[model samples]
Target: MKFLGNKSVASFLQVILTILLCSIIVGMLLQLLFSFWVKNSSNLNFPLQLNNSGLGEFARITTPFPVSYGFYIFFWTLVYTFQVMTAFIIFFAIRVFTFFKNNDPFSYKVVSSIKWIGVITIVMSSLQFLSEVVINIYFNHLDKLENGPIAYVRFNPGLSGIFFGLIILAIAQVFLEATKIKEEQSLTI
Candidate 1:
């Protein structure tokens, strides 16, 4: 099997990524509709319970309460933005694969797409981290003022995302250098 061209892994992944991209778009649209419906509907209460966790004493929240509309909208907006960013990353990946299918691995378009993916991933990861922190604080404190710290900081899962973004950025840099070298070779006699 060839590394590049229509019959190679890149082509297969391109097809898969295309399908995934479509699915994400459709899901986002559905989520938008759901958000509108939830906003207009009344008597809907969100219950938050942490005692169900197998950890006996580790769990803090035991009572269920309704979340505010402002928080709900904010949370969903953050989540939606994250999904959009993820779709952009997938879109860029698909572009990269398309270039691979065309046997143009070192093209400027491929390098640019890869770089965008890296940059978006980094920004998306930062947003996710900040949102997670805010959400966690809301859940833990439930907007109650107590004699303690302003916010309880916890280890966030988004750190892994930042690491992956940095890795992608490094890969993009390598690809840029490779493209430069390839262009130079083409120019040489």
Candidate 2:
């Protein structure tokens, strides 16, 4: 069945891509806000009440995780910055895709912006992965007074998922742009 004249397939694909793009943008914004909160409040101490002598001893002996206030702030700031950049990229990707799908000439500026955004997202995600690994390794060898490294390691999965998702989205955008280029070339010929 034909829909939207002869462009049913293209229209359908564009609609789905637009929805996915919007969802990613919203998710990135929420993540940015959460990272900001974590960074800002990283220094606030949360007292834990201990009734058991064994638990109290464990807590006391541990050197209580040294709050590297600066590191925490820097890490989260970087995350927020990258997420916001990724959102902008997604916005432009949707715009470019819609434009091309409608048989309109694609904007070179938008295409260039997507390319840079994809590259930045990939680099930022890599740095985040490395930072998390380093933090986990350092925390694992903490003294008896310090908290166990499990907490640091435990947070890895969620962070990794977000990073991987961004990478996948960026790659998809590259392929989508490539197809648009091919279609434009065919039309020109």
Q: Count the backbone clashes (under 3 Å) in each candidate.
A: 0, 7
For model 2, the superposed segments whose C-alpha errors exceed 4 Å read 1-66, 105-114, 141-189
- What lDDT does the true structure give each of the candidates? 0.79, 0.59
TM-score of each: 0.81, 0.46
lDDT of 1 by residue, 1-189 (tens): 787999999999999999999999999999887887765663433333345675543434332345677887897888798889989999999999999999999988888898899889879878877787777777567636433322344547677778888898889889989999999999995
Q: Candidate 1, after superposition: displacement of residue 50 in Å?
A: 9.2
What lDDT score is found at residue 130 in candidate 2?
71
What lDDT tens digits, residue by residue, belong to model 2 across residues 1-189? Answer: 433323765467667767877887778778766875655554433334455665653222233356566757666666667666666666665565565566643445445655666566666666667776766665555523475333334334345545665766676576567768877998999
For candidate 1, report its TM-score.
0.81
Q: Give the distance in Å from residue 130's predicted Cα in candidate 1 to where it truly belongs.
A: 0.7
State the number of backbone clashes in model 2: 7
